[model samples]
Target chain A: MFLLQLRNELRKLFGKKRTYLGFGMFLLAQSAFILVLKYGRGPNQSMMRMMQGNGYAAAHFFSNLTVATTTLLATAYVLLPLYVSLVGGDLVAKEAEDGTLRMILSRPISRLRILLIKWLAGVVFSLILILAFAVFGACFSRLFFPEGGLFVSIPWDGVFGVFEGVEGWQRYAAAHLVLTLKACTIMSLAFMFSCFDIKPAAATIVAISLVFISKIMQDTPYFHDMQGWFFTYHMNVWVYFFAAPIPWWKVGESLSILAGFNLTFFLIGSTAFQIRDFKS
Target chain B: MISLRNVRKNFGGQRAVEDLDLQVPAGEIFGLLGHNGAGKSTAIGMMLGQVWPTAGEIRICGHDIISQRQAALRKVGAIFETPVFYDYLSGWRNLEILSHYSAPTSRHRIGEVVEWVGLTGREHSRVRTYSHGMRTRLALAQALLPQPELLILDEPGDGLDPEGIHEMRLTILRLHREMGLTILLSSHLLNEVQQLCTRIAVMKKGRKVFDGPLSAINKSQSWIRLRVNDFPSAVELLRRERLITDEREGSLIAVAPGSGTEHVVRCLVAQGISVYEIAPQEQTLEDSYLDLMKFDGPAPSGKQQLQPSVLATEH
Candidate 1:
């Protein structure tokens, strides 16, 4: 029964034009980034200089895997949260505003089940959005860059890694998989706000605003000691996949905290939705 | 099939439905009539489990709405106030989606219901392309999708042209007469209610001002209809004798309740005026509804009010 209803929910979700906005935006952004990397000399010079300073052959590191991984890092932080929040915020609030929630609730199904199904649908959408990002990155990179070794560096985090052969591609896939966790977390936050008596846009805006604020607080030197408490800090757990030997412990801790966050968001959202009156 | 006991709903400090105890028996078409904000929609909402009652219990088909809501709503289908749908989806898809919430309905059944509500050819069209009348029909189709034993419709004829209203009325009547389904319809369209419902309850403010069979409204007034050969002479005699207070058409007379039919007949015959027909004049539903709207006091507990009688006499 859950699967049946989830299918129905997915149909409703994908039937709307707004749900495809993320896919389109990612396609455009990835294509543009690849085009600039191919045509612009400044970015290549900076990359070559950074590689030389770190003592690696710059040409060997400028691979399809490197470009794709870099594209995910550059775009996932900003674009992923925005699009996931947009979809999650609309899952429930839009229906309420449109007056369709009343009719839907008029059925024999419990409100809790409906909320669960919708939340699960949002999670699925987040996963699909991340998958699309990965696919687009790989395709656009292959179109312009040659396949070679992988090089990744986040200077502020004091991380630089190099890998060749199957290990780099394996890490690349794992990174995209872990990136889904970040998308789901932001989506859940927006979904919680969506259950409240607010408009869809307001829900999305509030969710995105909270993410930005958390990110800023995490970056602040004053809150450096409490980094583990901020979701924005834990959201960077995917970046660890690019680390040498991989920090499994850090990944596990971040995953546990995010799983807890997801549960709490679902609980709060289901409760609010259960108690709300569909007076519209 | 439907019952409410002392149900009350308050939005903030404002009362939407107060002490509303109503029963709609099996296989009866019950009309819920009220003006705007009279809480007809609110009461229907409670019955549908859309609005939680501030006090009291509502049961549908012997299932308690609060504790056994799914069970209660299992046999009930409704369209409260406006019939809203997913405008992006086609009518067929909307019905297909809505029908999945209950027992799975087959595509053949969906097509049959589409034709039942006169949306056969247009079921493939997007709801946004549908007019108000088509939307109402689509709402009817979805409500019938569950093959509900009890159908609660709030203002089904609202925003429809006369022809559309007529079609909706016919569909409702067919559902009741053919399917033997119990119906609780809420509307301010008195004529439509009068034609479709066998029993009705009228709401005022947030309370039930009157409830009984359709015959009770007309019976509240003790009026006698009369026809005479000499219309003017009979009218003059009756007026002079102070028996008839109002005249109707060319010959009919509104005999006062104080004067018996015997006295009016005796006086008219004594004046050599031949009486053609004499019977109690039945009031229209409109007349009874207007009379109830003029009522100023709370309804008697657990009893249908006959206050409209006094108001009818005053009329």
Candidate 2:
């Protein structure tokens, strides 16, 4: 049954026109970013040049790529949530709105099982989106830089750091993995909002609103006391992976919090969906 | 078999269904007849365990709908007002998704049901491309994929062409006769229900006003038409003799409830009226339904008075 559901989810993700829209947006954004980095001599190139003067070298070039890619993917902090929202938001609400819930619910399976399948499908879609970003980001970044190590320039602290002498492939792989996990957390949050709303637009709005609101609140002085608990505060936790010696404590805490958020919201979504009247 | 005992449902303070009790026997076709907002959908929802009843018990195949929902739902298949499918998926793929919920249904069964609903050649076509009738057939195909014991169809014939309606009727009859699947169908189309259902329940304002065999309900009222050369004199003669109470329908006079053709013919001829035609009017399910619901208050005591001949057919 689970396999059947997985197959159905995969089919829906691949077959729907909207799925291609998401991929198209990702391609467009990645290409534009690559163009700016290679030909436009944008802020990223200026930063790279400044880091090079501060004792940065080829051994740490991947580290610079990671920072640049992470900054570029932040744009997805807005775009990807909308995509996730469109898919997940329709998980249950679309069925109800379209009057398909009645036929789906009439099957022998329990409502919990149906909801679990939908939630899992949403997660799978989210995973695919993250993977797309990681793969595209890597191709674009490598095209422009063509270097072996990342040069990190911290403007605020007046310090220059480099992951010198590290294997470029390993650094890029680790950076992509960390960014993918961070995007997973955001996608999961958007999915939770989707479960609560019947309208795809409404779900997307709410999910994006939460992310943007949390970002603003984390930076606000009044919200200083609650910064550590906000999911947005840890959105940059992937940066810790690039830090020398790696801040395992902050990394583990952020991962744990994100995991907890995912589980909590997934559970809430399944429960509400299981009990909700399928009638629109 | 499905049974509802004193089922009541409310949305906020407004009652959607109230004190509704009905039992649909195994392998029989039971029609639920009502107007818009008559709580037919709500009742179906509660029976399917999609919506909780504010109060009452719904049992499907002897399993409680609330406490043992999965077991109850296991024996049921439903098609709500419209055909709902993943528009992006092929018709075959939609059925494949539903097949997961039931006992491991085989590909052969899926193919069989697809053919049964007459979608064999179009099974691979995306559902978004299907016509309304085709979608309806696909929805019915999905419902039958599980081979459930009970089928609850709400307005299954709505939007269907005459040919589609005929095909649906045949399909439903086959399910009952060959598969022995009990069916609870709700529709506003009176003639279809009249032709299909063995038993029916009628609702008005969220309350059940009539329930029992179709014959008994139809037998409660009768109409007779008397055509006379001197229409006014014949009408006055019939009224004076108290043989038939009537109202005008064009030049023809329609007699009231108990007036039989034989009685009207005898009375009119004895009164020296020139009777052109004395025919027994066919009492339709619609007329019977209107008569049943005509009363503003509680139904008058004792089985509604009908002519002896009508009573004879009723029993």
Number of the top TM-score candidate? 1
Instruction: Summarize candidate 1's per-residue lDDT along B129-209 as a digit string, tens digits.
Output: 999988998998889999899998888887889998898899888998899899999988899999999888889899988
Pairs with backbone N, CA or C atoms under 3 Å apart (clashes), candidate 1: none
Q: Candidate 2, residue A106: CA error in Å? A: 1.4
Tell me the lDDT of candidate 1.
0.86
CAPRI-style docking class of model 2 based on DockQ: medium
Q: What share of the true interface contacts does each candidate keep?
A: 0.64, 0.65
Q: Which candidate number has the best lDDT?
A: 1
Name the TM-score of candidate 1: 0.89
Q: Lowest summed-lDDT stretch of 10 residues in model 2 chain B? A: B295-304
Each model's lDDT: 0.86, 0.73
| DockQ of each two-chain model | 0.55, 0.55
Tens digits of per-residue lDDT for model 2, B32-133 = 988889889989988888888999989999999888887888878888776778888999988887777776678999999998888989999999999998
